[model samples]
Each structure stands twice: as C-alpha cells, then as structure tokens.
Target: MKFKFVALVATAVAAQFVAPVASANDQLAQSICAYVADNNKNNLRKTLSDNRLRLKAVYDGISCDGLPLVRFAIKNNAADTAEFIIKQLPGSQVAQSGDIEWANSNGFAASPILEVIKARSAS
Candidate 1:
C-alpha cells in the first residue's frame, strides 16, 4: 500500500511539472488585451516590451474581428501604439488595415498610417 501511494504521488508530481506553461506570446496577448480594455497607453507601452509579445502574437491578437485589448487603443485613436505595432509587424496587412479603419471610423483619424496601408496594398 505504501509503495502504491508513493507511485501515485510521483505520477501526480510528474504530470504537474510536465504541463505546458503559458507561452510568453500568450501572456503578452493577454496583457495587451487588458491594456486596451483599460485604455491605459502607458501600461500598454510597457507591456509591449515583453518578449512573449511576438509579431505573430500581435498579429493574431489584433487581427480578425480585432482583439479586445488592441480594440480599445484603436477605438480611442491611440495612433502611436498602433503605429508601434505596425512597425513591429510590418507584414501584417490585415492587422494594420483593421487598426487604421477602426481608428478612422471611430473618429480618431490616423491618416498617416492609413496612407502606409494604402501604399502597401497598392504594391
């Protein structure tokens, strides 16, 4: 009985240790989402430095219908933050376009970024 108990405990410990931790990209996405929701530009800027916030994560998080985190910044006309993200993921046309449109439609004109998107689209 003691041996069986030890084996079970060992198995549980191994399973716990082997579980995959949240990737840095995932953490960054969550943080970005939070910052966007809070409309806290300063916190958003700081969160961008996390290595887990990769270009792919940024693109994935901000693209499609738009992630809630970045949606806040886009809606608020946070052009600088949006620009920074564009710079980070230059290849992300969908994210760039979505952000620019969200800003423009929401009364936060980001013409310069829009111009860039247009130029890229033209090419």
Candidate 2:
C-alpha cells in the first residue's frame, strides 16, 4: 500500500511537470500560426529566435489549420511568409514535399510564391 501510494504521488508529480511543457508547445504553435496569418515576419522570426528554435527544425512539426506551414501561408494569402518559409527550407525538401504540385492542383499556381519554390528547388 505504501509503495502504491508513493508510485501514485510520483506519477502525479511527473504529470504536473509534463503538462506545462505540452501547453507551452501548444502556445508556441498558436503564436506561430497567428504570426503567419498576419504576415508578420519580424515577430515570427523573433518568436523562433526567442525559443531557440530553427524554423527548419520545427517546420515539419507545425501545421496551421491542418495545413503545413508553407501551404498554410499560401492558403492565407501570406505571400511573404510563404516565400520566407520556402527559402528557409532545403531545396530538396521543397521539391520533395510536392508543394509546387499541390499548389497547381489547388489553383495556387498563379501565386508568385510558386516561382520562389521553383527557384529554390533549382538552386
């Protein structure tokens, strides 16, 4: 009975520590989404820098309204953010992610960001 109580207490303590970390991550993601939506590149960069996060490192983990970062930017007509994100990503990743194809299929082919993606992929 004592052992079980100790285990339960330990579990509760562990959960208290874990919950804040998860919430922090959620808050960070929300901030990123908001920044992207607003096309506020400076704030976005500041947030990532403050968190010691490289955009490329966290890119795959983030989705804005269920769309990947670049796609989300395109959807929101955040051209500056979209181009910035595309340029930060590796050319191979940009090409292999099929963003160009997705954009064409989704009627985003006219977006100038597509040109940026193509250029980045070529380089």
Candidate 3:
C-alpha cells in the first residue's frame, strides 16, 4: 500500500512538469502566442524553430493589431522578449510587414518595434 501511494504521488508530480510541453502542430502556434504574451522568450524560442511553418505561425499568431511578434512584444512592454523575437526573423521574414498605420493611429509610434520597422522601411 505504501509503494502504491508513492507511485501515485510520483505520477502526479511528473504530470505537473509534463503539462507545458505541447508538441502538436495544431496547438503549436497558439502555445507560442501564450508564451510570447507572457514574455517568456526562452520558451518562445524553443517552441519556434527556424522551420518555415513555425516561423509563419509565430508571425501570424502573436498580434493585437496585425503587428509582428516583435511589435506585440514591444507593445506589451517586453523589450527583452522583443529582442529575442527580432533575432528569429531573417531574409524574407525580416521584410515581413505589420500595421504601421495602426501603430501610428494608436500612438505606438514611439515603440521600439515601430522604430525598428520604420528604419527598415526607410531603405
């Protein structure tokens, strides 16, 4: 009976640790969005590889006004998170556009992401 009780406790503890690891393709994007919103850059980076589809999901999933992931991070006041997201983008992804007019109209023009986007858009 004591052995059985110990096994049950061990299983419950393992379940707690295992719950956050979501690998299903269908749920990956949403999970990444949650991590980004929470400003958990380490988990966000782990959830999104350089894989095209994952990157696209990260691009599309984390947004409040059609903003890119980095913009969302900046808007949420997560500069460290924003930096981590910016490092993930490259090539065509670097040129990926967000809602500049929305940021401008919403008075996010001073945001770090907005500044970076404007600089890139300039030339």
Which one is best on lDDT?
2
Candidate 1: misplaced stretches above 4 Å?
A: 1-11, 14-20, 23-27, 35-53, 61-72, 95-113, 119-123
- On lDDT, the stronger of 1 and 2 is 2
* Regions of model 2 farther than 4 Å from truth: none
Q: Is candidate 1 or candidate 2 better by TM-score?
A: 2
Q: For model 2, state the Cα shift of residue 104 in Å.
A: 1.0
Top candidate (TM-score):
2
Across 1-123, the per-residue lDDT of candidate 2 in tens digits comes to 999999999999999999999999999999999999998888998999899999999999999899899888887888888888888899899989888898889989898888888899998
**C-alpha local distance difference test of each model:** 0.56, 0.90, 0.63
Q: What's the ranking of the predictions by TM-score, best on top?
A: 2, 3, 1
Ranking by lDDT: 2, 3, 1
Writing each residue's lDDT as its tens digit, candidate 1 over 3-116 gives 999999999998776664545445656767665545565676676554444554555545323544335555554556545555555454544446556657777574455554
Task: Give TM-scores for every candidate, taking all chains together and pairing residue i with residue i.
Answer: 0.49, 0.95, 0.53
- Model 1 residue pairs with clashes: 24-52, 33-69
Q: How far is 47's C-alpha from truth in model 2 (Å)?
A: 0.5
Q: Write the per-residue lDDT of candidate 3 for residues 93-112, one digit (tens) a residue.
A: 54545546666777777777
Residue 60 error, candidate 2, Å? 0.8
